[model samples]
Target: MQTNNSVLVTQQIKTWLEQVVIGLNLCPFAKRPYKQKQVKIAISTASDDDTLLQDLLQQFKLLENTPIETTETSVLVVTNHLQDFFDYNDFLNLADALIEQYNWQGVFQIASFHPHYQFAGTTEQDPENLTNKAPYPILHILRESSLDKAVESHPDVDGIPEQNIAKMNQLTKEQITELFGYLKD
Candidate 1:
């Protein structure tokens, strides 16, 4: 049962991934899986932590049951909860604990993205923080094996963050507004 708002939210995320994440080459590994339609964008309408945790577990189970070729990764879009960056950041600890509790630590990993993502030592308006910002709070579930393969094949895996930050720094004010217009709302 998906609502129009859910559909719109999913589309907004897809656009962000395509135009910003992959188009700008922020993630070298993303283009392949995305183009192959192996990326799953799941929208969670949960407004509470408990329900959100359940949704996250379902995503973990889905990835565990599905093959790599069929579904390489999943981005769980949290629509109603964790809008506050601090709360979202705090919830990541519980997300990790859940992985450990389920013994999925080695099998899966979670990457976070949020509308107001801010890295440590960076101000809220810092351009570098824009690197992780998305239309809504997102829990990007990734397969450890696939990530290992990608890292093994890539030449400079450790440089990706620095490179992304540099790219974000290079963007003009107008360019930032153009790319992240949804943030204005």
Candidate 2:
């Protein structure tokens, strides 16, 4: 399998997100519906990163009665891997699941460092389109030379530290799967 620093960074972020979700007592999917005030983040190398997405949904399902269906969802799909960089078929499948199965009507907020970045099968015409071309306000994080660069480029009123994109270029599928599963038990 291909490997590089980008993969490592992706793994780190995924692991961090999973840990945060559980640590914040947001596990067992059923609990998510009531915590409407929480600004939860779900990160992945790609939106189609099945290992991460499936685990998230399964965990959410564990605690809530809401159908595992996604609905008008607002989420940030962070990645160094852009739409053209990965398999298009996988991306489409991910979108289908989110739109049809999950009932997610909210825009999918995508944050990527790729110049050709685009969410698969998502167009500006779709109500879910939330990107550079769209008019809706978005928070996009991109690659920079350092954490300082990220901060300088993407500033916040609260003085939050800009998240440095990890170089995730050396990870195996098993490693990725293990990382994705690290938070539950």
Candidate 3:
């Protein structure tokens, strides 16, 4: 069901992941799955919260049913609804409730990303916001097993956010603006 636009958006996400994330060592764990072709990117077309929840459930099942080595993770990209960061942020509650609704506790987790991602206690212009900002709203779905392995190997997990903030703070405004422009359109 992926259209041309869906392909384009997923490609853009890949570009961002390569050029900014793995390229900059922002996520030390990302490179492995990406290189092994274990990453699944799906462009969601749901226009409402309920439909979006269903789409997420479907993706969750797809990843769960597939072999771990085949697809270790999935990124559900939403280019349709939840453009507003506040709404997108609030939607995580619903997303989390789905895991409980289906008795999927400890089986999956959803990480949020948005074009205008702003961390709590920070303003919109804060450089640290760049850490989670993406070309579009996305739900990064990861198997709890995979995450457990990743976390076990990464002893400095708690320091990641601080390191990302410091890294983004090192960039000048021009560089940040250029990267943001590349991500958008």
Best by the lDDT measure: 1
Cα lDDT for residue 128, candidate 1 = 93
Residue-level lDDT of model 2, residues 34-121, one tens digit each, is 2542333334443436654554454333323322233212234444333443453345455446444655333232233222324468
Candidate order by decreasing lDDT: 1, 3, 2
Per-residue alpha-carbon lDDT of model 1 for 106-174, expressed as tens digits?
899999999999999989899999989999999999999999999999999999999999999999999
Better of 2 and 3 by lDDT: 3
**lDDT: which is higher, 1 or 2?**
1
Candidate 1 versus the native: TM-score? 0.98
Measured with C-alpha atoms, the lDDT of residue 46 in candidate 3 is 92
Cα displacement (angstroms), candidate 1, residue 43, comes to 0.6
Q: How accurate is candidate 2 locally (lDDT)?
A: 0.34
lDDT of each: 0.94, 0.34, 0.89
How far does residue 5 in candidate 1 sit from its true spot (Å)? Answer: 1.3
The alpha-carbon deviation from the true structure for residue 135 of candidate 2, after best TM-score superposition, in angstroms, is 17
TM-scores of the candidates are: 0.98, 0.27, 0.94
Candidate 1 regions off by >4 Å? none
Model 3 segments more than 4 A misplaced: 182-185
Model 1: how large is the Cα RMSD against the reference? 0.8
The most accurate candidate by TM-score is 1
Q: Stretches of candidate 2 above 4 Å error?
A: 1-38, 45-48, 55-73, 80-90, 102-115, 118-185
